[model samples]
Target: MPHFCRIVKSGIAAPLLAATLLLLPPAAQADHADWHHGLSLIDKLKYAPDFPHYDYVNPEAPKGGDVKLSTTGTFDTFNPVLDKGQPAVGLALVFDTLLKSADDEISTGYGLLAEGVSYPADISSATFRLRQEAKWADGKPVTPEDVVFSLDRSKELDPLYANYYKHVTSAEKTGERDVTFHFDQKNNRELPNILGQLQILPKHWWEGQGPDGKPRDITKTTLEPVMGSGPYKIAAFSAGASVRYELRDDYWGKSLNVNVGQNNFGSISYTFFGDRDVEFEAFRSGNSDYWLENIAARWATGYDFPAVKDGRVKRESLPNPLRATGVMQALVPNMRRAPFNDERVRQALNFTLDFEEMNRTVFYNAYTRVDSYFWNTDLASSGLPQDAELAILEEVKDKVPPEVFTAPYKNPVGGTPQAGRDNLRRAIALLKEAGFELKGNRMVEAKTGKPFSFEILLSSDTLERVALPYAQNLKKIGIDARVRTVDASQYTNRTRAFDYDMTWIVWAQTLSPGNEQLDYWGSRSATEQGSRNYAGIADPGVDALINKVIFAKDRDTLVAATKALDRVLLAHNYVVPLYYKRDMNIAYWDKFSRPAELPTYAIGFPTIWWSKNASPK
Candidate 1:
């Protein structure tokens, strides 16, 4: 989510999808179909009657060509646990999950590494059957031992590496190629998505000590590429530089159902660029074959290249369904900080935001305003409040006060800001009562005599442009605020330490949302090294609700707990929800093509990509 604006050197490559291919009508002057045109019919032939539902798994799929692909980031290491970017991309080619998320349905996985996922009816612990097919890049068989080693190391590793495995309680080897995972509880629909994130590593290769003579923390030792079971193994790696993943000619999972016709590219090489403009120029001139444009100006307009007119490059602007529809980017207040500790102050700050002006002027009309936590999607909360949430608010009306909920949450320009103003006025009164006063229009604490001025941090020029408008509005509300622009390197460190007063960022939630709802908004995650609590929240009630949702074994109970938590967060105004943009700006070469019809979920680039010809090596 932090990379929403910052250009990354890694991510899934958008498929070279050919959208809306022509299917000629029959009424063409009593047309006689020519032999050349008849071949097009063969292109749409069904070779397997039983497998008729397969979308892109054409047995006739042409092979033998090396598809050159490029993403924004480099895969500098082979250790799946250590490297987040390139390893994630590379793992897709080499390893297999216990269960495959095939077209939104859970399916029995083919054994490249795993044969099947076993769960008892009560579902407390699940066992994974490893295929004899699984092997390291060096051809050593992958076993249950490797699975156990990886999971154990992940749980014991430093916060940076362990954060991803926060919920996995423990992993154990039950047999040669069989492993069992004991969850803290049962019934998580996200089990499939979580499994997909795992990448099998070679346990034996990493067993030795490092140069320091101490047990190596796999994450920090980035000297070599990781040995994995994926289609490609690390060919070469340059620290903080470039990485090359060469195809494993003897790949174990080559013919698996989930991998069939996937990872077709012979090799993928990723190179990093500190400057996005430089990266865009490389993409235009063929130095870089692929890159996604984040600047709205480039997407709404056209690429400034001769190849576009010559038909060598194709650009498709499609709607993204997987992204968070409600607040992709948000303005979060630091609840741990004083003055902001009060609910009225937080609500007032949310009201003070002028999203309409920001969207139009700053974003160049590239975004839409979002009122609820879920912006444009069906998952976003409607105007109707959840019964439990409303009930909780009713009970707390006396102690913490209920105007925070009674006040109509409105966008200042479209709806009335009375609730916002009333809240702000109350904030002013409370501050005065707390022995603070408006000195020359800026709120100043009487005790410390410190002005209520804070800085907001962001990583991109685009965000800088948008944040300036929000800062100006805060200035009008007697708060002195300024936008702090930092390079990607500095920005990442500051955010990791929760170093800023206020920040603008987003989170990518899973489709079948789970207990991470707790991690994002719960009190326990507030101070963790890698927590998403940008607000520094520590409310016990919010924490209790989050835990309830996380441990809920039934869907209805999970939904009820989550909805209640969402309202509690809304009441606190820990985060000011911004608009979610439906349209995504994607630009690529026309030579790449994909199946005519795209899956509703895979409309974005990576899932739909296929190259018509090889890219420059």
Candidate 2:
């Protein structure tokens, strides 16, 4: 899967909800003596401490050969913690996390750098004992100090990490090889598993003087690859154009059970192209080894090349079996801006989108309309709120839109010309209600006569096709909506600063939605720079419902709370919901061999695959 700053669950499997939380027996709860080799937020772990290898990997797979992949956009930094620059793809390969997630499970993680983890019954603090054999690339033993420094430094340097680790009070070295993370509150079962996702950094390498004899700053971007303790190390690179990672033959954990069948390539190289079109051309010309097709139009008609015909290149549309299709990709209207702040205006904008036409024409009828913020998931509210969901919403009825309880939320349907005209009339009436009147071809303020105009900021030209049609619809209402395409870095900076009237944004959801919901829709994050609340949502109803979601006591309450949040957010029209596909379209060369059954949650490419004819380098 491609790396987005925001964490998202990809695939169509039902997410692990509150109901999936394991309930321990009385005897098990009574004894605090037994420590665990892994942690899970939902289901009980499937692997034992002495388990040899994961079910989805070939333990005896040979490791050699090179796999060349292509990526769009340029990366100027090798640092993964910073939010500003585009970090190199696959940088995670060079760093080790304290615990590694099993791809087949929704919420289980086995110890990677840590040998064991222990927590009290109340789950306030978690203690991890570092593996004695763990060592950095520079041959320094991985220590408790490194773990503590990583947590504190990450929280200080990145807002995402700060929000993710907000409840975590401090990480202290309890023993020579043991580190304990203290939390401000207890009973957040997800916290321990989330902490396992921490990508540990070598404190000594980062704090030491660089080649230029200057102290290295963790907050700044650096092209000189820093020392890491993972299976691969940066061998060579051409700044933004390309980067190659050479496998560490003497890696300490290569033979570990969690790593036996993974990182099979001796070296992995990523070549960057300016855009998807050029990248596709490079792949077709045999310059790149793999490509994950995202464009429906291209997927339907662009695979007639000679390589594919000759069977050298393969195309596959695989089913995502690990997660529910939970994504809200939309034209996010910045509520902080004028006109958009008005609920009537935001609602009117949604009336103008013709998703049915877009899917049929541009998408080759490959996508389904995204009706809910939590689309294709149990968390999505369907029909009108009822039962437990209704009970939750009743408390906030006075504060939310009345229609949230009275009518089911639905996007305006438009397929034919007549349907489009009817929807446009409805939109015009809503705009008129919001104090705007169509004057000839321009919608202007009724009193001051100021033209209603805003630019739809875009990062890729591929989106121009989708935005241009939407702009045409907005133009019908006399709204001067123009599409402006910029580079990825510019788009990242502008969106991070919340400096646009309207822009394309995606909020990816996970199986167990927890504290991250605060960063996504919390009032505090609305004003925070580099926050993910792109719509600038700060509703009291949303904030209250998010709390309900964060501190939900059981599966039933969590489900009800999540549905309530979904209903309120949909009612607000913060974004014009777009479309999503249930399947992942991917293409790769035929030189690699993979397990018969892939992991449930991920593509498991590169990680659980080996070259057909290769040996250890």
Candidate 3:
């Protein structure tokens, strides 16, 4: 779960969980007495109630001109909340949440649509007072009724939101301009903050008929441009090829503190290409204005074009100051599948991955091995569990692997041929202990005499570079590992259905880990379709630990619980840990200008940026 502040991505769903408890501290009780301008999950907010704008933005920055961008896959829907189709990339620009997050803060939200929010110290419920000035794109005032409707509809329509807000029993319009959400539990501090992340929908527009006279359905994907309250509106679109958003002159909240210097582009367009290589060519030819390089090979040596050398283009490797770039991108073996269910077999798979060699050869030594699920963070497990973390792990000591206590988890090293051979030998031993033996050139199960073979499912041709090497390595151990590349749509559907033997899974972590942990590793999500549990992990110990992290009373306990969970996850060997780079590789044509100070957590593109050459109004 990427720490998406306001807008939820098209195919990727957000987080959710349920708990039952009641009791609020004195501090929480006092907070409910008066409405606050913002909410923070852990620390005090950096910005004061009357702060003019975020420090990262230029409040007087000029805004105009058009920007062209690119997306790898196609999109069929403008409706972002639906899970069925690929929603347009810039669809998030059209909506406004009750509260908006500041990029500099880890887990804090300032008032956006709402003027202020309040919750009792007991935290039984949170009440939000909507700003009378806030209006929909259709010019209708945003009401408490619309907020209530949006909450109810989201919980009813999307499984992701359903599970995320399961603890919230009801959302009702308690006053003319105020709406309250009642939670089933107390001390679950993240509830109010997470609720602030909700993208409020216009109840009237959703219930009304479309231009074709058919009733609009929020649950279904549609090509029709919907009404939104944000700065941009849908200008033009082709079903699956492209979409354009034009800034609205009558847009509400354009003068708000949060909106002071953001949404700079007069028009923003995104073109979709089937192949990444072709996309790069388009970018090189100046068809696109910006490109975020994810491929190391391209970043290392692919940007020697004439334009780059002539000063028309700029390439940079900016340091990512937001969150850890240590995402767990790896070969996730589906635990529901045979052989993968065995702990020893999973361990053998991890041993066969020669990341050290791959980093040198394929990645040009530009990456480092990811050792922890919470990699590059203080929350990651280190030398040994102690104090609070040890006490938490002790509760699950009997359930988790014993090595978690005795040793620090480490991936098998293999930079030299001799090291590779040694690692292969160790993998073979583990497989044999799991009741598998090599007969001739094939490895077969000892009891059933079944040959071991599986497909490494890939969504893009680029992944073949990584998968092919691993498959060749597996072949050396007498295991038939086939690499299959499917189209983007098919890959999305199949992965959502958990219909694969092995696939690349990237689980990005946030500094404030909370309910989202359940969606990533909880038992219930393991079997649930459209859930983020890509590996099908259903361990009871993992489930309990996730709960511990969620219901943690303070930041210290949350960190401890998260580290303990990390230790257990690494011991399981559920994934062949891949590699990550610390810096973000970015390249763009020098047509746009941005703030001197970038947001701590994000690039703040399009938003908080403007055209260097803008026409006077």
Candidate 4:
């Protein structure tokens, strides 16, 4: 029979447990004492240099305990189609991805449901084979039907998901154990990575609503799907407040070596808070076990906990994986708007902001000033290119000036200033030459009655803290800049729909940057709502160049094409490159630890684990 354990109410450590223990008989009280003391043993292990990578073995590792989790912001939905964070956290234990990047070098899909997937020579089609032993949480066979249902449902539910599924023309079931995906494009370079985001929902549970409830579809069908081939299944959920997932005793993929290190808890419970102060208090008083420090200032100076001084809390700053973004933040210009439509105006805007000052003053000297849109990475250009490469970039040279491309913004007084006051003067002069003038302290186009007044949206706490200094610089240039703050959900909605005038955004232009460049600065992508084209950029030259890069079969050609594209983007000043954070700030309870062999990519959690003596539920 399944063991019956008390459902520990969600929040900070409960005082009721101690009172309940005192009321029990002598033998029961002794057992309760042992359990309480055993749980406290976690503090002893907290001082260990490293935590065990694999700690979820049944019988080998004790089971039937809960792992309480707390995070800021509640979820409105569990569907990944609309939500990115909540569903991802829940799905990490409740659902398995087809392909997962275990480390920097490999992309593995050691069949939880599907054994292996491969691409053909043409690179247009991919074939997947299922592991014979894979089964759903309810002990039913997981077949190709479930995969197709998930794909179709995702696309039908939201168009944003359809954009992600655009490459796959169709998902065809070859046999009971085999399936194939045909892409519309020559290659789906990030196909495996994309697959990791597509979690399978049970067709059986989804066809009809379960007891816990499900989302209503366009057809007015309420679908509740809890069936999935993962380590755990949702036992109970409180809409946005909290969610409880229980470990599946007869999990199909348990024996696989890949499954050993992840999903360590018997039951994983998550509680959400809308405020940072509340979340911090929860962490300080020992409610939340882990915290991913995104705010630099908060990480550097906010905490002076006794636990930290006493070495009971561990803190480490790790690098952010380039997968999230090439650069953390950038100033994007609306190319669709006039004056900014001119190449000179765009280049002038880029020259106006002094990154060096912004880095030192605004960032508290914690960041590296960025030059290229794709910086530091191999995709970025090192020096002047050869004849053929120069020719391609030179074709668009007439529209842009050499000074704009090569020279740094000149200042009247020596030394770099964060706002670059002299650069702002040059920018104003350039706009004036391009039929723009300051009217009542606002930059307006002489030909058109349009004013250069725009809004800048940001979501990061650190960005919010430092954005004022940057805003002041724009004001100095006689530009009307409005800074708007929003939560993660609102931010996602605003950016996804291309509903804002201007914004501070970042895209990690990784090592093998792909042709999705079209999405950010291309004509085709601008027409589509919710496209990554934040500034409504629509350049024909940019589109053609992106196409060339995408089709280039050879690695050298691809590299050269990418460099050429980067130069074009820089010269056009599509995005004003900002600064990159050199340090990664992460803090957690001392009981947790990670391995020494770190990957080049930022660690997102596949490599992290807890010590044996961690708190028991």
TM-score of each: 0.79, 0.94, 0.95, 0.78
Q: Rank the candidate models, highest TM-score first.
A: 3, 2, 1, 4
lDDT at position 212, candidate 2: 93
In angstroms, give how far residue 595 of model 4 lies from its true place: 3.5
lDDT of 2 by residue, 1-617 (tens): 11123332111122222212223321122124345788765567889889999998988889988899987778899987887787888788898988887778765778899988777778777778899999999889999999999999888988888887899999999888889888899777667767877889999999999999999989899998878899999999998899999999889899889998999988899998878789889988888888887789999999998888999899988765326436788888999899899988998999889888998889999998888777767888999899999998998887788988888988899989999999999999999999999889999999999999999998778788899999999998899998998876788778878999999876667666778788889999999888778889998989989888877787788889899899899988889988878778888878898888888767787878888877744
TM-score of 2: 0.94
Q: Candidate 3 lDDT, tens digit per residue, 1-617?
A: 23332122221122111111112222354234477888765567778889999889988787789999997778888876776777787876898887777777666778999988777877778888899999999899999888888888877866677767778899988888889899998767777777877888899999999999999999898999988888899999998898999999898999999888888899999999988899999999999999978788888899999999999999887764425333566788999899899989999998898988988899999988989988887888987889999999999888787887889999899999999999999999999999999999888998998999999888778778788999999999999999998876787788878899998877767667777778778898888877778888999888889889988887799899999999999988989888777777789999988888788776778788889877634
Residue 451 in candidate 2, Cα distance off native in Å: 0.6
The alpha-carbon deviation from the true structure for residue 76 of candidate 2, after best TM-score superposition, in angstroms, is 1.2
Check candidate 3 and list the clashing pairs.
16-164, 24-122, 28-121, 29-121
Give the per-residue Cα lDDT of candidate 3 at 611.
Answer: 93
lDDT of 4 at 354: 63
Q: Which window of 10 residues has the lowest lDDT sum in candidate 3?
A: 11-20
lDDT of 3: 0.81
Question: What stretches of model 2 exceed 4 Å from their correct place?
Answer: 1-33
RMSD of 1: 10.6
RMSD of each: 10.6, 3.1, 3.1, 13.4
**lDDT for every model?**
0.54, 0.81, 0.81, 0.56
